[model samples]
Target: MTATSTTAPIRIGVMGAHSTGKTLLLQRIEMTLRGYGIPVNRTGQLGKRAALVPLPKMQHHTVASTEWVLAQGIADEIAAAARPGPEPIQVVLADRAAWDALAYWHAAQEWRQETPHRHDRERLLVLAATQAPKYHLLLATALDPDIPVDSRHAYDTRYRTLVDQHTHRLLAAEGIEHHRVTSDPDSQARAVDRAVKLCLKEAVV
Candidate 1:
């Protein structure tokens, strides 16, 4: 594989609405890349980690929680990129990135008919937008209601659909290019592998 131009590791963020197989896609991509002998590191959901304060669900996301998740995500991405590796072609696969947090913030606001704290929301929005370019591949998981959402996680169909819509619009408005993956597992793996190879090839040029 051609080494990326920058010292920064290539970031691949998997994002979508709730229950869209984001986690599965992240895992499959990492596994597929490793099978090819490429070095890859993975990052999980930052918002779910024990935060300074407990974060509420998407329908109740607060400004503080949203900002924390976004900041933690950026910090985690930086650390992932800086991880020691023998080769310069390290890839970082993130299950969910800052963009997802921003999308959820909007989703939550709309769902609850409430807006986040103006100052913090604006600040985090700016930060997320700036850092988004670090992601060499932002793969959007296609909304697949065929896959059931665990009731324990979130069972709101409306909320999930709204989040998916918000995320799609944000990516487009920000001019961040992304590829949508189908629900089929095999198809997902193939699509992701193709995108990763193409991205790695482009990076070196």
Candidate 2:
């Protein structure tokens, strides 16, 4: 395949609910892509993925809840790992994204407004913002109740909406096109493959 000077490895991130086979899906993608000799890198395989679990120092902020923290860490690692544009297609699998909307909404009610934002907020946002242009695609893995599940908050539909909303906002703000995939792992993999084929084309001119 001919290469282009402006094109690079399309960075792909996979996100979804806990214990919903995200790891399995990630592995599947890596294996399938590798089989085709299409360079694919798993964050863990690189031994540098940042897991964004919340820290106890500042659990007070709802926006930086544990789940959100997990997402932030994953986002951070991907951002940090990303080299400037103009390279081959690279794929990074992050298990989660910023998902503290539920907690944030709950706290927004009682918590006093006008207070300075926490450190986590700035850092996490910076990570998302900076990586927006660096990534070619953002894949959101939906909660898969198929393989056993539990509603952290009664599986509240509201929370899911908020989660997707928060993610969309972040991606939009960063100027990146984000896509939400279904619970079916196969769909997720196929989507990535299709996106690569479509977006990673060689020089057009």
Candidate 3:
């Protein structure tokens, strides 16, 4: 669904595994919108902030960490949308959507071969989905093993793959509408174009 209220900023949320170009995609969208003179705000680096909470992250993510990530992302989006300014922000870009944490948590559980409590799992899913409706557009990146990553950082290939799988799986399970961005440059460009068009079109509505 499109943004219905003129007062509320159109929110575009991107989610995917680490180093999957989620941040870059949002940056491109932000730049394009700003070029059109659209005031925009972007929220990101939630994983880093969550790590500061002294909470387990990455392959070690726990329910507490996941909840914190989801809640904090929601709060950040709200604050961005409500930013006080003369121009008034027309769009808010969320780097990692709320359900991202849920995908990571699922990947962590599978990596550790641990079975979490059913109630806790369901609760987190519900919490993560709370912000789903607020997103005017959602983008999910697909991991491409062929696309080499930075050699400086040591990433767990297996776990990273798991996160990618779970990310798409969760999205499909929930039947949430989203654009799937791949490693192809053309695909990335199209995703950015879609986001830009969506914001501009919704703004005039």
Candidate 4:
């Protein structure tokens, strides 16, 4: 594998629309990589219709399942980055990134959370600047534009379009290679594996 190197294992983030198989894809990556005895880390917060609410005090808010998945993703990526290793690849699977922007953008447009406009750049800046370390591999998913949407989902898709488009470009500009996984889980997972191979190309002997 010949890919960009930062004197450490590459950092990765996996995020896509619902049912795009973000978790499934991550599972595949982990299963496949672990066969080689390489180090990997995984965490996610899924927004199922009904999921466990572990935090009693914060139960009122009852954070949605999707938020939990994204939070785990963020944390796992940060943890993986903190370690130094001789292996060429360390993979972190995050089911969603830039998820909060959905509510933030919606509030700006409908609830008047702020001005009438919300910018992807602003939300993006916040994500990149997190206390958590940054990622080098960003495997993004294209929303199945055909999927039906409720009012909330409709708004989310709109914001995701801008966010997704610019995220790929931003990472590339920073020398982080980008890959897009489609609707099919197997195909998407294969694409992710290939992307990792590409990112680790420089490490191949």
lDDT of 3 by residue, 87-122 (tens): 788899999988888999999999999998999999
lDDT of each: 0.75, 0.47, 0.89, 0.50
Backbone clashes in candidate 2 total 9
- Poorly placed runs, candidate 1 (over 4 Å): 1-8, 50-52, 85-89, 116-120, 184-187, 199-205
TM-score of each: 0.84, 0.53, 0.95, 0.54
- Write down the worst ten-residue block by lDDT for model 1: 1-10
| lDDT for model 3 | 0.89
Which segments of candidate 2 are over 4 A away from where they belong?
A: 1-7, 44-91, 94-123, 144-147, 150-165, 168-176, 195-205
Per-residue lDDT tens digits of candidate 2, residues 75-130?
A: 55556347354544354444443332222332332333434356755664554454
Model 1, TM vs. native: 0.84
- Per TM-score, the best of the predicted structures is 3
Q: Model 4, range 39-148, lDDT digits (tens) per residue?
A: 66665653431245553111122223324434554655566555566753455555555443233233223322234324544544455445124555557666677766
Model 1 agreement with the true structure over 1-205: per-residue lDDT tens digits = 1223444467778778877888878877777777766777888867568243567757677777777777878778777767776765577887787788889888888888876778877787897887666777778877877777777984577878889889888888877777777788776877677756854554432
Better of 2 and 3 by lDDT: 3
- Using TM-score as the yardstick, the better of models 2 and 3 is 3
102 in model 1: Cα distance from truth in Å? 0.5
Instruction: List the candidate numbers ranked by TM-score, top first.
Output: 3, 1, 4, 2
